[model samples]
Target: MNWTVISDNWLFFLVGAYPYGPLGGLLLTLLLAVGAGILATLLGIGWGLSLTLTSGHIHRLLQSVCEVLRAIPVLLLMFWCFFLLPIVFGIDVPGVLTVIAALALVSGAYLAYAMAAGIAAVPAGQWEAAQASGLSQRQTLRWVVLPQALRIVQPSFVNQWVTLVKDTSLAYIVGVAEFTFVANQVNSREQVYPLEVFGFIALVYLLLCSAVQALGQRLLVKPS
Candidate 1:
């Protein structure tokens, strides 16, 4: 309950020794989460849009891939990529890279489902109107349908971002040296106050997630 400990170690929690060395702690966590989420969103949008436009065979394949990825646990995915990827592929990937890849795969599958739902909810008339206006399929998607669908799914997308932020904690399992990892290291070193370190980590996560949710709400209301 002593706030002084947190005040004293706030820099460590935020960036570890990143200014003088490699990045670690909350900054690393946010970087991993945001980078993975952005890559996942791109992949998801492509697959989701393909599902709307492609033949049954392609749709089935995409659906199955998403299902498989969604079914796997994040921790398992991270462990598999961390250990097996190097051995099986002869690629010497770092733990942090593996964690980011695992998260991106998982996030892409979930986002595909969300985006598919959003696209499906768009009216058929919109498509017809775009066609009548002499727009190509790509043009319609870029300028019309996607814009509307994205707006409709803004709330759900924001929720997914929040989930991704929290899920960054799982990166600790793969030794990514993120916020949670740093806290655990601190806890191990200061064994007399393990609870205090973990409690502060929890508070940091809560604050970050809350800030994202608030920002999402503000973006929803502000004229775009």
Candidate 2:
């Protein structure tokens, strides 16, 4: 492996065309993942909880919307967000933000179902006990249900987060210049170290994903 290629171009891979150009690179990758994770949690869990707790018109409407989102491919979503967002909404949206939104929608679609399963896994007695204690339905959900449901689905949420991290690679198609994109650029320019450069890229992704998994597992573990 020509370690020097990575050694020399590490900064570019880490931060991309920064301080001189729009931000892009592994930093952008993290930004995209984190941003998407937050948005996905809000959209996915909120919808899941609402659907589980609600019924009739509200549930049917949400089910239809999420079903449509889930049916659309993530790549198509990214393209639509980038190309059509401005035209349809008549407002500018940067490429990176567009990618984040797309990833969030993709990840959230799956997460919503996972959250619903978690909520369903909660026992019926727990709901009754909360009501027996004179807690409102909202209070019961907030204090008793959410904690348990979210905890039960911790592994799934973590998996979705890791999946989103990997999906950041797709942003390259739209010129996001994240980790994979920057690495590819360096390899192309140098043209002598595909194996070495890609090997380094794999290592970086491994480290990133491992750290995330470790932290998630730690959080998911039962208290002693």
Say which candidate scores most in lDDT.
Answer: 2
Kindly give the stretch of ten consecutive residues in candidate 2 with the minimal lDDT sum: 215-224
lDDT by residue for model 2 (39-143), tens = 997888988898898899988998888889889988888888888878999878888888998999888988898899898999999999999999999999888
What local distance difference test score does each model get? 0.82, 0.87
Give every collision pair in model 1: none
lDDT of 1 at 35: 90
Number of clashes found in candidate 2? 0
- Candidate 1: where is the Cα deviation over 4 Å? 17-21, 218-224
Q: Each prediction's TM-score against the native?
A: 0.90, 0.94
Model 1 TM-score, all chains together:
0.90
